[model samples]
Target chain A: MITIVAKSIVKEGKLETFKALAQEMVEKSRKEKGCITYQLYQDIHNDHVMTFIEEWEDMESVEAHQKTEHFEKNVPKMKALRHPSSEMTLYKKYI
Target chain B: MITIVAKSIVKEGKLETFKALAQEMVEKSRKEKGCITYQLYQDIHNDHVMTFIEEWEDMESVEAHQKTEHFEKNVPKMKALRHPSSEMTLYKKYI
Candidate 1:
């Protein structure tokens, strides 16, 4: 299994709208095949630092997720509402 | 439950030692009373990036963990081997 830790800092005043739009994306992402977990999290110390903690079967699954209609539709919207500090790290179980 | 995503960059050449030292801590942490998950992961794209994905019953359980013998003994060593970029984020489920 592969795990992905994604962090994106939202624009100064678009938190609510970003989350509202994410609601649908999250639901759809969770239902995708090979997706084990697709959940959103808000940083306890910083409200603007939102994260997506995700798990998938493998690289193939991850690519599949990126090509989905939900991701296609929401990513553009999300990108427009976020700063450039977004980053994602993929990891494999070590212990 | 609370989930924690902790990122720590191992010092230039101490990755192997850090992982070896973490072996015992990971075992002991998983055996803690309220720990649901206490596992490690190495970033696939960047070997220097390591992440600890944790789950605990609540804030009290989390506090208890930091005070445990294993954490106390190992953290200082780990800190000495890590860069200053280490940051930990606490998150509550938001799916």
Candidate 2:
């Protein structure tokens, strides 16, 4: 299994809207095949910061997730809704 | 090997403070033995959202980290300065 941790900085005043979107995204992602868990988190120190912990069965499933409509469509919307320069990382299971 | 994904929601109006903490934590963690990578991220849509992606050589290392002064001390401060809730998960590498 592998885990993907994603973090994004929202605009100065979009925390609420972002939270709603995150909640929705988490719900949808949880139903995907090979997804063990998908959770949305808000930083206790930053009102505009959010993160996600996503677990998948393997790389193929993760890659598939990228190709899904949920990702393709929402990514643009997510970008449009956020500040520029969001950070994302992918971790391969080496253990 | 293993990966730990941690998410925390800072109280409203504490983004900068939390970011600084996260930055310091990441820096300290990266230098530890068995740590492959430790990165801090802020959500693009929420300033209060913070996430961490930590890769370790094994569960033993991870457990050891928990006992480090860096963790034990900061954790309480982390808990006290926040909105009272944070989420953390450990992932075992199966791939």
Candidate 3:
């Protein structure tokens, strides 16, 4: 499985809109094939920081996910409201 | 559930040792009560970065986990081998 840890810092005054977009993306992403889990999380210590923890069956599935309409539409919108320090890291299970 | 995303940058020359210590912690943490998941993952884009993704039943369960023997023994040792940018974030499910 491949896991994605997307940590985003929402821009000031855009929390609500950012969340709405994220929730919509999450709901749609969960329905895609090979999706093991896809969920949104808020940092307990930093309210402006949101995380998307996603588990896909394989790299092929993840590639397919990028081509989906929801991804194409929402991701750019989300990025426009994000600050520069945000990070997206791909991970492979270890140990 | 409470999820912890621990992203640590291993010190130079400590990758193998860090992995060994992390694997031992994963093995023990998995046996703790209320531990839904305890895993180690290597960053696909950066060899120096390792992440520990942990899920527990609730706040109480997470508190209990901090007091476990494995935690007491290994965490500090692991920390010593970590670089300065390491972060540990607690998250609450938002959707």
Best by lDDT: 3
TM-score of each model, in listed order: 0.95, 0.52, 0.95
Which has the better lDDT: candidate 2, or candidate 3?
A: 3
True contacts kept of 3: 0.98
Candidate 3: give the clashing pairs.
none
lDDT of 1 by residue, A1-95 (tens): 99999888899999998998788888998899999998898877778888898999999999999999989999989988989978889999988
Per-candidate alpha-carbon RMSD to the true structure: 1.2, 11.7, 1.2
Which CAPRI tier for candidate 2?
A: incorrect
Estimate how well candidate 1 is docked, as a DockQ score: 0.82
Q: Which stretches of candidate 2 lie over 4 Å from their true place?
A: A1-95
**Fnat across every predicted model, in order:** 0.92, 0.00, 0.98
Candidate 2 residue lDDT tens string, B1-95: 67677767788877666666667677777888889888775554565766677779987788888888778867776766577556775655321
Interface RMSD of 1: 1.1
lDDT of 2 by residue, A10-36 (tens): 887776777666776777788899998
Listed models, DockQ each: 0.82, 0.05, 0.89
Task: Give the winner by TM-score: 1 or 2.
Answer: 1
lDDT at residue B89 of model 1 (Cα atoms): 89
Find the candidate with the highest DockQ and give its number. 3
Candidate 1 ranges with C-alpha deviation above 4 Å = none
